[model samples]
Target: MEINLIFKIAAVGILITILGQILKHSGREEHAFLISLAGLILVLTWILPYIYDLFVMIQDLFDL
Candidate 1:
């Protein structure tokens, strides 16, 4: 929920896009794919804790 987290995610996405483009242009499409996948996983890891916390809060609110 912090602004910096959003910035960090955006920064990672930009860096990944740049790297992927470079790799693809260099004829390393497979590596570019892996880099994109890794970037996705990295972003998910960063956001998952917040998602889990939200779910927990919702569950508590509804007494689920």
Candidate 2:
């Protein structure tokens, strides 16, 4: 819930996009694709815990 997490995610996304573009333009298209995929997975990994916590909270609230 910290403000810093938002910044971190944004920064990672921007960096990944830039890096992917650089790699692709440099002719390493495959690596660029993999880099983008890895970045997505990495971002998901960072966010998954928070998402799980939210789901747990919702379940508890609904007595599920």
Candidate 3:
């Protein structure tokens, strides 16, 4: 994990929160939900590789 990745995730979270708030205030609740979901998926994609590496390391540690 790198510092840059954490920064990127934080930026995305901030942007998504702002956007979702705007959408909700504008009565676009469904769109806000979608936007939040997209953000979650986006962040998950970004972190998926690290998650896989973690799992691999755990497996190695346990000799699984």
Candidate 4:
């Protein structure tokens, strides 16, 4: 699971970089910026649950 997530992030990063470059060179500056931001948000959405779970576990561990 960890390895898969690592690969997924790496791939997304590479793809976003390539996409941004392509968009910039194509004279779509605004769309390229938005595309990168959208990619970041998408990745964050996917990882939010895991982050929440981690915090919950920590809270329980310390009885917070």
Highest-lDDT candidate: 3
Give the root-mean-square deviation of each candidate in angstroms: 0.6, 0.9, 0.4, 1.1
Best by TM-score: 3
Question: Candidate 2 regions off by >4 Å?
Answer: none
lDDT (tens digit, per residue) of candidate 4 on 1-64: 3789878888898999999999999999999999899889988987998999999999999999
For candidate 4, the clash count comes to 0
Better of 1 and 3 by TM-score: 3
TM-score, per-candidate, Cα-based = 0.95, 0.91, 0.98, 0.89
- Over the stretch 1-64, how does candidate 3's per-residue lDDT look in tens digits? 9999999999999999999999999999999999999999999999999999999999999999
Cα lDDT listed for each candidate: 0.98, 0.93, 0.99, 0.91
Off by over 4 Å in 4: none
| Error at 44, model 3, angstroms | 0.1
Model 1: residue 13 alpha-carbon error in angstroms? 0.4
Model 1, position 5: C-alpha lDDT score: 95
* For model 4, the run of ten residues with the poorest summed lDDT: 1-10
Give the TM-score comparing model 4 with the true structure, all chains together: 0.89
Tens digits of per-residue lDDT for model 1 on 1-64?
Answer: 9999999999999999999999999999999999999999999999999999999999999999
Error in Å for residue 47 of model 4: 0.8
Q: Report residue 26 deviation for candidate 3 (angstroms).
A: 0.4
Ranking by TM-score: 3, 1, 2, 4
